[model samples]
Target chain A: MIGVGKVKQYSNVLDKPLSKGKQEVSLSAFAFLFSELVQYNQTQVDNIAELERRLEDAGYSVGARVLELLCHRDKGNRRETRLLGILSFVHSTVWKVLFGKVADSLEKGTEHEDEYMISEKELLVNRFISIPKDMGTFNCGAFVAGIVRGVLDSAGFPAVVTAHFVPIEGQQRPRTTILIKFAEEVLKREARLG
Target chain B: MAPAGPRSGDAIFASAERVNAELFTLTYGAIVRQLLTDLEEVEEVNKQLDQMGYNIGIRLVDEFLAKSNVSRCIDFKETAEVIAKVGFKMFLGVTASVTNWDADGTCCSIVLEDNPLVDFVELPDTCQGLYYCNVLSGVIRGALEMVSMKTEVTWARDMLRGDDAFELQVKLLKQVPEEYPYKDDE
Candidate 1:
């Protein structure tokens, strides 16, 4: 058992800065577990879309909490504002908090000032995702989309988040990109800010 | 009123890394067992699993915010750093790297390493080339929305093509009102 002092120190240290300590888990375990989840959902899935939706919904819940925990730990209990600014925060901060790395790229919409993109060369989900021949149209990335939607929705960024597969050749893992489309009012605000 | 970003001293990762992983596994096991318990309709069990994940996401949002300590993101760079250091480390025990940075620095790409979650997991013959770890994406999307910044997450490729790498693209969509309604509009 850990002593009170050690626990306090752990709490204090982790509470403030961003930590990069080594922690490992079993991929097979997660895979088997998730497999069961997919299998269970498939039975009730009226269609491929429905099955994916269920998965997305599940992820959405996790996204909500993931966003909160990360922000709380880094900011020491402060909330952020600024639409484009916060999105970048999510691309980097939130991504790191959940997947353990800052995203590969963060892009802004050249045509629409209110729009932006967070790009990663390798998504954590696709790292070991293997779709079966039967479920051809199924892309579990929707689960990720749901999580993004949930996070943004919870944070007051009422927008739609969709997960798509943008495959790039020569890359070992699938390159998945999440597209975020902001509401009209949000664009208006960005225009005014400029 | 809610506290401003980074000011409340709320970002604290109190759980031990090992314990946290165990918690996720335990939760996974429990969810699976419950679903398989009755040998009843699979749909019902799946629904239950989704509901369970939703509940977990809701709670995780609060926990993530409290641990990250990133009250406010002044700009994109700071936001990215926070994700790499605080966000990823706290939950997954790995930090992604930034690659292919745009000249203006407004855009950049992230690379992930040391992913224990993906280590040694083989997809069953039925699901040959699908990503099983998309739960992270869902969790992230749901969590970020709570604090604002309408966003979307997508995959960059199909993982079945013997491709050892995968990517996720994030796009910024809209800005939600600070006092926005939590419930969906009919």
Candidate 2:
């Protein structure tokens, strides 16, 4: 709330300068808050799938916001128009700011050209809560999948995003993978742009 | 290195693992939006938010105790001070001031001039009855209860409601003796 130059009145949020993404809070604070989010949603829904859908919906809005905020602040108002450009942005820029680091790996699907996979050993939410079958894989990743979808969709890339459990040979818990399959129009547009 | 005396709010905040505030702020906003959509009633949303905050407070108090090494034996007055100075700072990266204490020292206000929760937030005309930050009051109440202090916390003012600042009024309702570590030293 520190004023920039002198005492002034801001009639709206738009009037305020966009924060430089410098402010911070302890990781525990966020973890506690996020835990409550999942718990509250759980009470509202009857089954696990419904609960995961609700969590995804919640994350969608956050992803949408982060896209707009980061684009304006960091990219000098230039948005990624190409498929690779946007995916890279989501991988490096969006993931870094939101999760504190780049995602572990972003790989193109060998069988399908229209799909991409983003894998993380332990996503932020996965590290805190223990899921039934695995840690970050099945239940905990829906929200993150939603975030990726939100970013891609709002950026005009309309895609179907899903989360899956990938078992490591020696690891006790399976890591999480986000599978993103782009719509036909998006691929058509990418080909046109190229 | 652990310092000799109790660490200040700034010192603990500097050392703790941190995350981007925008992520936290956006995540909270998303939660509020989801609650409003599901509950429909503003009153119900407030209650749910408070309940969630209470859950967090009960768990967070343990971390607060472990991190902030203040003298254990203190009265309700000092306890409020620590929560304002340390608890808020350690978690939210903000500092609040404890003021306007009653003559008996059973009640006071935690005044926050700048709050991250309210940033970029404006009360829509339809949500006039919503105490958007009820979760904070619930957190204080639940945290105090864990330490054997039954308390009542309410919002006296909110910036979204056009108040100059955010103020939470906390009243010490009862004190049960059960090997409480934060008893007053006399």
Candidate 3:
């Protein structure tokens, strides 16, 4: 019987000779599956907010576990502090851990000094997100936000993250902006430490 | 140590980036299928999810507690607040604030300023009149219960409105056993 621990080992036994490279997968399957997942969750909940909360929780589990595993892998040496340090970690470490590529853009919030925005143009979760007019409440990109939140908080960067779709008229794909706002205490602490 | 690839090496341990999105979807599908096979009733599905989340929450508390080196919350009231700010933020990227702290201040309302999962896309037509997804409510309820705090999750806004934001209210229902229930299982 294979347990959760063995699942990783099993992959190696079957594939043999694992190498580091990009693996292409069918976007259709994920889209369809996510579509159904939303459908399934819909039947069980009472409202749209509930559904989004459910999806957020689902992503939350991934974030929590992923954060644990990633920290274990990285040897958990130093904790992250300050905005730029954490952003770099998100861009290089968390992005590499989850999406394989560094995000397309990492910009500080122009309006707010404390807020930093991490934008991804070709987000995998949003590739097939089709918000129906009737059910105007759902966004699949919350999963990515969960992951980011997980990684950042795990690394000791306390922040609030929000996902939004900012459409660029000429841009081919939707640009997702993850607004990360660090806690005031965190900023204060960073200043003291720096 | 060599870096792990998606297919080979310790994917989680090696920080592999080559993971195929399809495989992640497949994993999600497999877990849901497994759950479905064991559970039939809609209520049962929700129950199982809560049960599973309860277990996860117990373990998660241990991890977070260890990493943050945070002392146990002074009370379940504090525990609920911590979960919303720290627990939710750590995993979901959204910090739910206490919009309506109860008269007793035990039950609190949490407002979700941003949700990452629903970033670019929108829920389709078929899912209307139904709760978008409530696994989170079940999870929070279950996890807090495990930690000895009874809580119920309610939505502040309906998602069908195409409103720019989403919010949820968590009501503390009862005080749970002081000792976590899942401790013996591990």
lDDT string, candidate 3, A1-194, tens digits: 11112212221222333222233323332443455556556766797767766665566555655555445546365545556877887777767756767898898888987898889886767775667788664566766776677667766776777777788889866688887888787788778888
**How does candidate 2 fare on TM-score?**
0.92
Q: How close is each model in CA RMSD to the real structure?
A: 23.9, 4.2, 22.1
lDDT of each: 0.55, 0.85, 0.56
**Candidate number achieving the greatest lDDT relative to the actual structure:** 2
> What is the Cα-based lDDT of residue A84 in candidate 3?
82
State how far residue A84 of model 3 sits from its true place (Å). Answer: 2.4
Error of 1 at A169 (Å): 3.4
> For model 2, how does the per-residue alpha-carbon lDDT over B1-186 read when each residue is reduced to its tens digit?
444435357788889988888888888898988888989999998998899889998998998888887766468998888888888998899888888899999999988745777666777988888988888988998898998899999998776776667889999999967785566884
List each candidate's DockQ score. 0.03, 0.50, 0.04
Report the CA-based lDDT of candidate 2 relative to the real structure. 0.85
Report the Cα lDDT for candidate 3.
Answer: 0.56
Model 3 docking tier (incorrect/acceptable/medium/high): incorrect
- List, residue by residue over B1-186, the lDDT tens digit for candidate 3: 444212211222122122444234333533343345545444565465555445445555554444333356666556666665665554443355555666787766655654433321233443343333344555577556656677777666633335434556788777755665477768
Task: Give one digit per residue, the lDDT tens place, for model 1 in B24-57.
Answer: 4333533443354543454454445444444344
